[model samples]
Target: PVPVLLNYIYSPSTSMFVSLLSVDLPKPTLTVEPESSVFSGESVTLKCEIKGYDGWTYQWYKQDKQSRWSAVSQSEYYTVNRDTLTIRADAVIHGDQYRCSGERHDRLTSSQYSDFVTLTINALPTATLTVEPEGPVFTGGSVTLKCEIQSHSNWRYQWYKGSSRTAVSQSETNTFTIRSAADQDQYWCRGERDDRPSSSQPSNTVTLTVKGEAKAVLSIKPDKHVFRGEAVTLRCDIQWGRDTECKYSWYKEANTLYSSSTTQEFRFSPAEESHSGNYTCSGEDIGNSGYSQSSDAVTLTVTEGPVFSGESVTLKCEIQSHSNWRYQWYKGSRRTAVSQSQTNTFTIRSAADQDQDQYWCRGERDYRPTSSQPSNTVTLTVKGKISNFPLPQMSTYLMFGTPKVLYLIENNAKT
Candidate 1:
């Protein structure tokens, strides 16, 4: 009797019962540390993470080339943590697909597999360090260190000192410039790419041997003693240093002949008496502040010897050391001891043809016979001579006739 009443009592709300069931969670995300593409032998970390969740056990899977998925185990090439995996050895092979999934520890709910991530291994490029001006460098000189990576252009460079890992300089370009290089400068370089942000192996270490400041030697082309109006060329040579390009400065005693010159050869078209002083030169490396030591003083002797005939000529004996000197003149290798002047000049007034001879002078001081080096010989040439013309024939016949006429006139006047 109750069954008929119960069958008619079913409500629509009874069919809407709340169902309690577990919802499928979102898949975990897998990412590689640094980048997916990395150089072989470089350490890399693979991380599996589930956002906004805790106490999740992560399982990592690597898919082979045959499209078969298998669980990864801890081995020499891999170190497996709870949610992270590390590749320890040289990762040479490529095309390994990886995925990760997470499971809740309490509810035993599993998440779907993450999107596949592929790893690409590349061989590290070889880095080489090269120096500019490969010879021995000098102090305070500019030097460039170039890092070369063959077949690679998009690379950043890092320079380091000897055996030191700390980077002394970093540049987007490959070259590292040093404005003022010092002694004991050693360097090495490494190259890195921005895409992977991993550094290649260190390049060969390059040791920079900085030499000391070089001493410059000044030399004169031809003899230092040059005739007047002759061209003279002075050269500044730095024989020992790497800095061959230098600015030259020429000095005549205390006066500066040229303030700055890029050429090592200082030329004088027509050397004059003013250029007869003690000349010296110093060299400075281009773009450097310090100058080399002054060269040895060179004595430039300029003499003017041959003179025109019948002209008043003076023979001067000059010395670079002291002005106080007595002059003794010589003619044709004969020293004229009788005539001595306290001054350095010996003058010949009204020079005759006999005076045309080789003349030289020597210096003496304090009436001492000891003389300095003999001056260069100078020949004097006398030019013109007097001319005598024969006197006109005397008019003897006309003179006799005039005398006889005068006598006859005197006799007639007396008669």
Candidate 2:
């Protein structure tokens, strides 16, 4: 197609039109809105002004990496109305150049192309963080650590355990637990944002010391013999060289036994044969380490004499060996009523049939083990008038469900 000009005339005889064009106007001037600056999510307006232009149509073009200009306006990201065009800045506008060209009557002679105008969109700010624990856990445990920053925000957050960065979480919050005691290793967290010229200031650290599991060390006084019905105290101790906020517990065999944070002694009303077994103590440091090792075992023993039930008999508790010792007595095994004493002898007020069962004693020392042996078996014979009724050779008979009665003669003779 031939180029069209402003001075085209109609020739009726030849059925054609001639063109005449003139170039006398200055180039269009391009001015960016907002003084050539905008934030990443903001908009920018470009205005084109051309003098001496009539019936003008405007088109906008953007610059490419090779400095070449291409028409992109009149579509998305660009709007045209009269001589003004507006655009939304995307990530592509880091160093973009734009132009607005004007043309009138399609002559193309006096048309104007705008000067190169650069577009600058500021980057967005970003924030991110990392923590320890890596995962969930019990209240008290150790943790390792890790972290990274967000895109362009120039700010950072400092890690903290409780109030100090010296004990920050190691990784994501899931990575570690801060209860028992803070981690043994060094720790820190840094906050950084891209907007600021300098790095972010660290936050104050939160030092953490979680309470650990319960444990105790136990010691019994006087491992040797003790008198019946005497008082004895069991002491349970805990150790965490630097941490004193630990909890303590005492146990007998598999049972949970007792609990305390700082109670040193377990007082007993009285010592008896019922208290002859191994006892343990444990301590827990809630400040970071969970639990502690158990204390050494201790033994308690009580010696007493044998007593007879249902008959008048003498009861005594004695050491099988010649070791000097004390003794204690118990009607049954469960109840311990008397505190351990220095005397080796214990006497029942009255020997009855209930006291005829086997009984034994043990020895104890406050600082060491006390020695004691099982007492020799003693038989308590009923010495009342009618005590010989149940003999194998006796044909005893009762009337109307009444108990049978028998008479026994003195000098070990039965009647």
- Model 1: lDDT equals 0.69
| Weakest lDDT window of 10 consecutive positions for candidate 2 | 401-410
Task: Tell me the tens digit of each residue's lDDT in model 1 across 1-415.
Answer: 0112222333478855444444456678899875645777677788999887888888888887789999986988888899998877475356778888988879858888999888887777778899886776666767788999885567888999877779999989999988777856679999887655456777888888877766778888777877556788988887645445678888998689996788889888676545677888888766444457778888887544234444566655565554466667778967555357887666676677888877666676664334566655655656563234322211100001211110000000000
Candidate with maximal lDDT: 1
Model 1 residue runs over 4 Å out of place are 1-36, 44-77, 82-84, 89-120, 148-156, 171-173, 192-194, 240-244, 287-291, 304-415
Which candidate has the highest TM-score of all? 1
Instruction: List, residue by residue over 92-192, the lDDT tens digit for candidate 2.
Output: 36678888777777675545577878877665433233434333322345433333444434344445543453533333332333344434433445554
Give the distance in Å from residue 264's predicted Cα in candidate 2 to where it truly belongs: 15
For candidate 2, the TM-score is: 0.36
Clashing residue pairs found in predicted model 1? 309-383
Candidate 2's C-alpha runs over 4 A off are 1-24, 33-45, 50-55, 86-91, 106-111, 132-415
